[model samples]
Target: MFKKILIANRGEIACRVAATARRMAIQTVAVYSDADTHANHVRACDEAIHLGGSAPKDSYLRWEKILEAAKATGAQAIHPGYGFLSENEEFARACADAGLVFIGPPPSAIQAMGLKAESKQLMEKAGVPLVPGYHGSEQGPQLLQREADRIGYPVLIKASAGGGGKGMRAVDKAEDFAAALASCQREAINSFGDDAVLIEKYVQRPRHIEIQVFGDTHGNYVYLFERDCSVQRRHQKVLEEAPAPGMSETMRQQMGEAAVAAARAVKYVGAGTVEFIVEQREGGDMNFFFMEMNTRLQVEHPVTEAITGLDLVEWQLRVAAGEPLPAKQSELQIHGHAIEARICAENPDNGFLPATGTLAVYRKPLAHTSFQRSHLRIDDGVREGGQISPFYDSMIAKLIVHGATRAEALARLDAALAQMHIVGMATNVQFLRGVLRTESFSQAKLDTALIERERAVLFNQEPLGLPLAVAAAVAHTVLQEAEGAGRDPFDRRDGWRALGAAVRPFAFDFHGETHAAQLRYLHDGALYLQVGEVAGPLVIGRLPDGETEVEFNGRRHTLRVDELGGTAYIFGTQGATRITAIDRLAHAGDTQAEGGRLTAPMPGKVVSFAVKAGDKVSRGQALAVMEAMKMEHTIAAPADGTVEELLYVPGDQVAEGAELLRLAA
Candidate 1:
C-alpha cells in the first residue's frame, strides 16, 4: 500500500477518503482553498496544503497547483474524490507522467467515458442498450433542432462533458427547443468549457438506477449491486437506496452484467459507476437505457457501502497500488437494505436556492450504538460553528441508515431526519422528512418527478403557532434566570411585579412578523403570560439535564432550547421553531420601504442578464441569472417598470441581499 495519498478535493468526500486511508495505515494529505482553510477535511488529514482562491476554477480545478502540492508533500498517489478534477483525463495523464499514481480509472478509460456524445458512440459499439436520440458531432443549433424534431417533441438537451445536472434541459415542445438549447449550451460552456451537447428522447416515468462496478489491474471485475437514485429534483438526486425498490433478482443480474460489460468495453480500472435511465411501463415491465458512465466515485456511494460491507476507497487504493480486485463477482452479495438522504443547505420553498451562512445551531442525531442497533449514520464535513461558504457544493451532510428490510430502513430514516436540528440558514431537512413520510415514497412509488408531484406538502411551511412561540420566549427567560441564579441572590429577579405595571413586556419575531407578550410572576410563583387573546398561567420546571419542562393547563411538554446570539431555537415533537427576541426600543425608527429595488436572494456570481438599463420589463419577468453552489437561479422583476440601473454586470460576485438593480417607479 502507498505510504501517503493526497486528497485533491474538499468537503465530506475528502474527509471520507481520509478516513479509509488512515484505517489502512496510509497517511493522508489534504488540499484546501482559501475558503476551506479551517475546514473539517483539513483537520481530518495528516498534513494540509494550501491551494489558491475559494472558487473552484482558481483552486481545486488548478491541476498544476494540486500536482505541485502532492509532489511537495511527497504523496505517492492523488485521490480525486469525485468532483473537481476526478474525471479529467488530462489530470490523470499528468499524474502518471509525474511518477504519481492517480487513484482512479486509467486516462484512456476516463477519456472514453468523459464526454456524453463520445460515450454514447462507444456504448453503441459495445452493444449496450441505448436510448434513441442524436449523438452526432454536429454542433449547429439548426442541426440539433432537426434531430430533436426527428426524435420527438419531448427531448433532453444535455451537456456532453459535465454531470450533476449542470447544463441539462428538458424540452417538452418544439417551440421551446431553441431557448432551452441556448440556455443549456451557455451553462455547458460556462461549467465545462464545452458547448457541445447531445439530444436524447425523454423517457416517460424514468427511474435513475446506477450500478457500482469495480475493476482491477489484474483483469478482475465485480459489481457491488446497484443504487436506486430515482428520487431527484432538477436532474439531481435527493435520496438514494441500494437494491432498487422494485428490482427483481433477474433484472439485477441483467443490469449488473451489462454494467460490467460496459466497464470491460473501456478496459476500465478502479471505481466507476454505470448509470441507467430505467423506463417503467404500466404493464410492470422495465426497460433500461444506458445514460452515462461516471469515471470516478459517486457521491451516493455510501448506500452501496452500507449494503455490501465494503470500503470502495480501500479498493481504489489497493488497485492503484498494483493489487488485484479484492473479491470476485460471485463473492459479493447484498447484505441488507440501506438508504441515504442528502441534507443540503438550500431552501426548498425558494426554488431550492442554495444558502450560505454560519451554522449557529447545528446538531446531528445520535449514531447507531451497540446497545441501540439503530444503524443510523451521518457523513459530513461541517461542524456546529462552521460556515457554509458560497464557493462549494451546498450539500451539508448525508444521513444513511440500514436495516434488515426496506420498510425498517425507511422508518429509521424518517425518525433520524426528525431528530436533526439545523438553524441560521434554510435547509432541506424538513423537506426530506416530508418526502419520506409521503405515501408515494413510503410505498416505493418513486420517479424523477416524485418531488414535483408532491410539491405542495413537501414545500409547505407549517406556521409557528402561538403555543410554540410562547414556549420559545419562556424557554429563553428560564435559561436567563438559571444563568443569573448562580449570581448574587439580590440580582436573581424573576419578573417581579411592584404595582401591576405590566410586569415585563417581551417582543419576538417569527418568520419576519413581530409579536408581543406580557409575563408576570404570580403570587404562587407560577408565571402568567398573555399573548394576543390567550392568557395562561404556566410553571417552568428545570430538568437535571438542562431540558425545560413547561406545565400549563394540566399538560406537560418537554422542550430543547438552543440559544445562539439573540435567536432562541426551540425543538419539540412538532419541529424546530426559531424566534428572535426583538428589542422594540432599539428598532423604533427602523421602518424601511422595500420597493423598486432588486436584491439578490443569495450570494452568487451573475451568470447573465435578461434586461439591461432603460429596458421595459413586466412583472415576474426574468431579469438575471445567478450561479451559486454550482446551480443557477433566475432573479425576476417584482413589478412592471423600466430598468433604471443595472448595478452589477455579468460575472460580478454579489453577496446575499446585495442590490442587483433598481427600477424606475
Candidate 2:
C-alpha cells in the first residue's frame, strides 16, 4: 500500500476514507475550501491543504489545485470520495498523467459509465436487462418530447452525466413533460455542465437495488451482494439496507451476475456500484432493469461493509495498488442484515428543502466507526459549532446499524436515530423513525414512493410535542436555577420559605401557536405542570450523563434538552421539537406576513425571474426560481395578481423569506 494518499473531497465520505486509510497505517491528506477550514475531515487526516474560495467551482472542483496539493504533500494516490471529482474521468486521467494513482476505476471505465446514455447502450449490448426507453443522441426539445410520446407518459428524464437525484424529473403526463424536461435540462447543465439527458420508463412501485462490484488490475472481480435503496424522497435514497428483504438467492445471483457483466464490459477496476430498478408486480413477481453504474465508492457503502465483514474503502486502496481480488466470488457471503439512515440537515416537512445553520448542539449515540462488527457506526465530518455550508451537500452524517435479521435491523435503526440528537437546525431524525414504523417499510413492501405514500403519518406532529417540549424546557430551567442557588443563603429557591408553592407560568411559541404552561415547584422535590387543563406532577431531573429523566402522566421517559439563542429544543423518543420560551410578562407579539408578497423559501441564489413588473400571473404560476445546495426551487404565485416590483434580479443571493417580488391583486 502507498505511504500517503490525498482525499479529494469533503464531508462524511472524505472522513470515512481517512478512517480506513488510518487503520491501514496509510497517512492521508485532506483538501478543504475556505468554508471547511475547520471541518472534521481536515482534522481526520494527517495533513491538510487549503484550496480556494468556499464555492465548489473555486475550490473542491478545481482539479488542478487538488493535484498540486497531492503532489506537494508527496501523496502517492488520490481518492475522489464519491462526489465533486469522483466521476470526472478527466480528473482521473489527470491524476494518472501526474504520476499519481487514482483510487477508483480506470479512466476508460469512468468515461464509459459516466454518461447514462452511453452506459445504457453498453449495458444493452452486454445483454443486461434494460428498461424500455430512449437513450439516443438527440438534443432538440421537440425531438425529446416526440420520443417521450413514442415511448409513453410517466417517463423519467435524467441527466446523462450525473446522479444523486439532481437533474432528474419524473413526468406522469404528456402535458407536464415539457416543463419537467426543461427544468431537468437546466439542472443537468447546472450540476453536470451537460444538458444531455436520457429517457426511461418510470416504473411504478420501483425498488432501487444496487450490487457492489470490485475489480483490480489482475482482471479479478467479485460481487458483494446488494443493497435495497427503495425508501426515497425527491428521487433520492433516505434509507438503505443490505441483503434486501424477501430477496431470493436465485434472483440475487442473477442480478449480481448481470451487474458483474456490466462492470466487465467496461473493464471496470476498483470499487463500483451497478444500480438496478426493480419493479414489483402482482403475485410477488419482480423484475429488475439496469439503471446506471456509479464509478466510485458509494455513500451507502457502510451498510454493505457491515453485512459482508469487509472494508470497502480498504478494498479501494488495495485495488488501486494493483492487488488481486481479496476473496473468490463463492467465498463471499452475507453475514447479517444492516441498515443505514442518512441524517441530513434538511426540513422534511418542507418538501425536504435544505436548511443551513450552525450546529450548536450536536450529539450522537456512542457508536463505533470501524469495520469491527460492533453493530453501530456513525460517519460524520462536521463539528459542533460548524456551519452546514450551502456550497456542498446537506448530508450531516450517516447512521449504520447491524443486526441478525431484518426486523432486528429495523428496530436498531429506529433506536439509533432516536439516540442521535441534533439542535440548532432542522433534521429528519424523527421523520426517519416514522419511516421505519410505516407499514410499507416495516412490512418490506418497499418502493421509490415509500415516503410519498406514507406522507400522512411521517409528516404529522408528534402527539403532545408542544406541551412535552415546554415541560422539558421548564424542567431544565428550574433544575439549573435550583443548582445555582444551592450555595447562596439568600437565593434558596427550594419552595420552602414561600407560603404558597413557587409557581411559575411559561408562555411558549411552537411554530407560531402560543401555548400556556404553569410549573409549580413543590417541597417534595417534584414539579407540577398544568397546560390546557391537563395538570400533572412531573419528576424531572438531569442525569449524570446529561440525559433528562422525566416521570409524568404515569410514565418515565428519557429525553435531551438544549437551549441556544432563545430557542428551546427537546429530543425525545419520537423526534425533535423546537419551541421558543417567552418572558413571563410578554404576549406572543408575533406578526404574520402579508400574502401579497412572494418570497424566497430559503437562502439561495435567484436563478431567474419568470415575471417582471406589471406582468399578470395566476395562482400557482411560476414567478421565479432559486438555486440552493445545487437544486432548483421555483417560487410560485399565491393568488391571481400582477407583479408590482421585482426585488432582486437573477444571480442575486437572497435570504430565507426575503421578498423576491411584490404581487398585487
TM-score leader: 2
Let me know the TM-score candidate 2 reaches against the reference structure: 0.96
- In angstroms, give how far residue 333 of model 1 lies from its true place: 1.2
Clashing pairs in 1: none
lDDT of each: 0.88, 0.88
The number of clashing residue pairs in each candidate reads: 0, 0
Score every model by TM-score. 0.95, 0.96
Model 2: number of clashes?
A: 0
Candidate 2: stretches off by over 4 Å: 489-497, 521-526, 584-595
lDDT of model 2 at position 59:
97
State the lDDT at 429 in candidate 1.
85
- For residues 252-364, write the lDDT of model 2, one tens digit per residue: 99999999999899999999999999999898889999999999889999999998899999889888998888889989888889999999988888878899999988888
**Ten contiguous residues with the weakest lDDT in model 2:** 584-593
